[model samples]
Target: MLQTLDIEHRLKSTLDEFVADWGLDAEITAETWLVEDLGFDSIDVIQFIVAVETAFDKRNVGFQELIMQDGRYVDDLSVGQMATFLEARLPAA
Candidate 1:
C-alpha cells in the first residue's frame, strides 16, 4: 500500500529518469515547468505523458489533456502538478 507521498516521490524520480533518458539538460524539481523550463515540444509532451502512465502503472490517463487548453499545450506543467495528478489516481492508504 503506497502512500500519496511515496507515489509522488516515485513520480519525481521517474520524471528525472525520463528527462535524463531524453538527454535534456534541465534541473528537475517540483516547480520546474515541463515546456518553458525543460524545453519540451508537443512530441516530448506526448512521450512525457506516456512516461507518467508507465511509471504509475496506469493507461490512457490522458495526462496531456490536463496541461492543455483550447487544443494547445499549456506552457506550465510542473513536477508537483504531475505528482498531484497521479496522487489523485492512487488508492487510499
Candidate 2:
C-alpha cells in the first residue's frame, strides 16, 4: 500500500502535468470539474486518460472506474479523485 503522503503527491503531480498539456491552470488543491470547470466530455476524458497513462506509464484506464459519483455522490468529481484512483491502481514493478 502506498503511504497517504506519497499517494497524494503522485496524484497532484499527474494532475498538474496533464492540465498543463491541455493548457489548463489549476492548483494542487483545485477541484477539477468534468463538464463545467474543465469543459471535458467523453473524448476529453479519453485524451486526459491517455495523457496520464503516458506520463505515468500506466496501462490504459477505463472511464467508468474513475467516475466515482456515488455513496452520496451523484454524477461528477474533481481530477484529484481520478488521480487518486490511478495512483492506487498503478502496477508494481
Candidate 3:
C-alpha cells in the first residue's frame, strides 16, 4: 500500500502540472487552497478535477463527496485535503 506521504507527493506533482498548464506561477503546498490561494474559478476547478482524475486514472471515485457538503459546493479545498481524499479511494500500490 502507498503511504500517506507518497500520496501527498504524487498529488502535489499532479497539481504542479495543472498549474503549469494554466500558466500560474504560484507554488503548490499542502496548505494551498484551490480557490483562495490559487484563485480558481468554477471552470478552473472543473478543469482541475479532470486533471486530478486523469492523473490518478480514477473517474468514479466520488469526488462529489469531497467537494460538496450539506448539498452545497464547498468554498475551497486545500492540497492536503485532496491528497487525503485520494489516498482513501486509490487502490493499493
Best by TM-score: 3
Any residue pairs clashing in model 1, and if so which?
none
- Global lDDT of each model? 0.75, 0.61, 0.85
Q: Score residue 80 of candidate 1 by CA lDDT.
A: 79
Candidate number that wins on lDDT, 1 or 3: 3
Residue 63, candidate 1: alpha-carbon lDDT: 70
lDDT of 1 by residue, 1-93 (tens): 456578768877877887786677776777788888878888877887888778778797667567777998677777878777767665554
Q: Between candidates 2 and 3, which one is better according to TM-score?
A: 3
Instruction: Compute the lDDT of residue 8 as modeled in candidate 2.
Output: 59
Give candidate 1's error at residue 16 in angstroms.
1.6
- TM-score of each candidate structure, all chains considered together: 0.75, 0.58, 0.89
Candidate 3 Cα errors over 4 Å, as ranges: 21-23
- Judge candidate 3 at residue 8 and give its lDDT: 82
